[model samples]
Target: MQVFVTGTAGFIGYHLARRLLEDGHVVTGFDGVTDYYDVSLKRSRLAALQQYPQFSAIEGRLEDAGLLSETLERAQAEIVVHLAAQAGVRYSIEQPQSYISANLVGTANLLEAVRAHKPRHLLMASTSSVYGGNTKLPFSERDAADAPISLYAATKKSNEVMAHSYAHLFDIPTTMLRFFTVYGPWGRPDMALFKFVSAILAGQPIEIFGEGKMRRDFTFVDDLIEAMIRIMPLRPELGQPLQGDSLSAVAPYRVVNLAGGHPELLMDFVAAIETALGHKAAYTIKPMQAGDPRETAADTALLRELVGDLPRTPIKAGVASFVAWYRQYYRV
Candidate 1:
């Protein structure tokens, strides 16, 4: 299989691209190596992927439409997974224009490239944050996701509709994956787990947002990759919806939640980190930040129907694995 994956230097993209390469598939990765967090970390991930002979990488921003189109044309990818975007909920509040440039414009360019190349299957990343301001537990893909609290979520929601339009007009089969809180080895530094572990190890106080009252459906990175691998082949067909499907009536487009379907409290997650690090963390309880949700839960009926019996890694084990990796990587 020939796959073109954007955000290859990112956490989820790195895992997905590595898995594909290990399976002996030809993977052409694209990344801008932005300094959103740490450029060194992104460079390390790209270096790891470069070790694989089957893996090739292109260093360019998604905003560069000509480069993206030309690369897609040369790769001639059978499958295209769009994952690159300016990610960070609170950061989006600080730099809203970055979101517009990366999430909105970047995705629009990728869709155009895909429209021209016409891949067999197109999988784009969405977010559970799109189910904003809705007090519904276990969010379903069939539910309305029109109200997004943060600019980041709003951009992702825009991507979904944008892809739908292209799918309808260009006859592209597209699947939009709404991911919950994804964390594991080689995770992003801005994420909760990494911050908690780092603070605890350095004997610094960690800040617990929402006064430790928020809940999240945490999905391990490996589980997310597994679900994605299974979903890559199952393209949506019009009028062929499955039970509890989010398949579109007009286009070969569908939205599915990729998560463990289990919600855990913020305090419990912190406890797991403490257990993994063998050090109790000194933390201060703080009010929830703007545009942040009190809780997020995903209804995975559609996911299970599509990919049966996925591996759900326990929080303690997952945190432990990340701690181990963090210690080794940072030499802490």
Candidate 2:
């Protein structure tokens, strides 16, 4: 399969591209390699992907409609996975324009390109953050996600609607994946696990938000990738809705939550980090930051129906894998 994946420089994107390359698929990666965290990290990911003979990349922003369309048309991709975005909850508060440019305008350009060259399936990365302000214990796809607390979540929700409109008009088979708290090896530095491990290794105090009471359905990267790969071929079709589905009535599009359905406490997650690093992390309890949810738990009923029961990696093991990767990557 010729797969076109955006955000190949990102954590999940790098992992996904590597898996596809290993599976003998010709993959064309697209990334802006933004300096959101560390340019070196992004470059290192790209360097790793460059080793594959079947892997190629384009270093450009999604806002460049001409380049994006040209690249997509040339690739003749059978499958398209949209993962690139300005992807931080707190950062969106400070840099709202960046989110607008990347998530809004950039995604618009990608949709235009897709409209020009229709693929068999178009899978996009949405977030559980779209379940914002809803006190629902386990958020289902059928639940109302009209209220998003942050600009980042709002943009993602906008992406869902935007993609839905495209699917309805163009008959594009699209699936929107609402990811929970995803963590694992080669993870983002801005995420909680990375920050905690880095701070602990540096003998610094880690900040505990929501007084360490926040719970999250943390999905390991490998598990998320597996679910994504399986769901790739199960694109939604008009009038073919499954039981407990978020499938659209009018469009060939649906939303699925990619998660383990098990919510773990924040402090328990910290304990897993401590066990993984073989050292306790000093910490200060702090109030939850604005635009941050107290907890995020996904109802993955639709996910299970699409892809058989996924193997959920234990937090301890996942943390250990990430700690080892972090130590070796940083030579800590």
lDDT string for model 2 (138-199, tens) is 89999999999999999999999999999999999999999899998888999999999999
Task: Go through the candidates in order and give the clash count of each.
Answer: 0, 0
For model 2, state the Cα shift of residue 52 in Å: 0.8
Model 2 residue 29 distance off true place after TM-score fit, in angstroms? 0.3
Cα lDDT of model 1 by residue, 192-288, tens digit: 9999998899999999999899999999999999999999999999999999999999999999999999999999999999899999999999999
Clashing pairs in 2: none
Judge candidate 1 at residue 243 and give its lDDT: 97
| Model 1 lDDT on a 0 to 1 scale | 0.95
| Candidate lDDT (C-alpha), each | 0.95, 0.94
Which whole-number lDDT from 0 to 100 does residue 155 have in model 2?
100
List clashing residue pairs in candidate 1. Answer: none
> Number of clashing pairs, model 1?
0
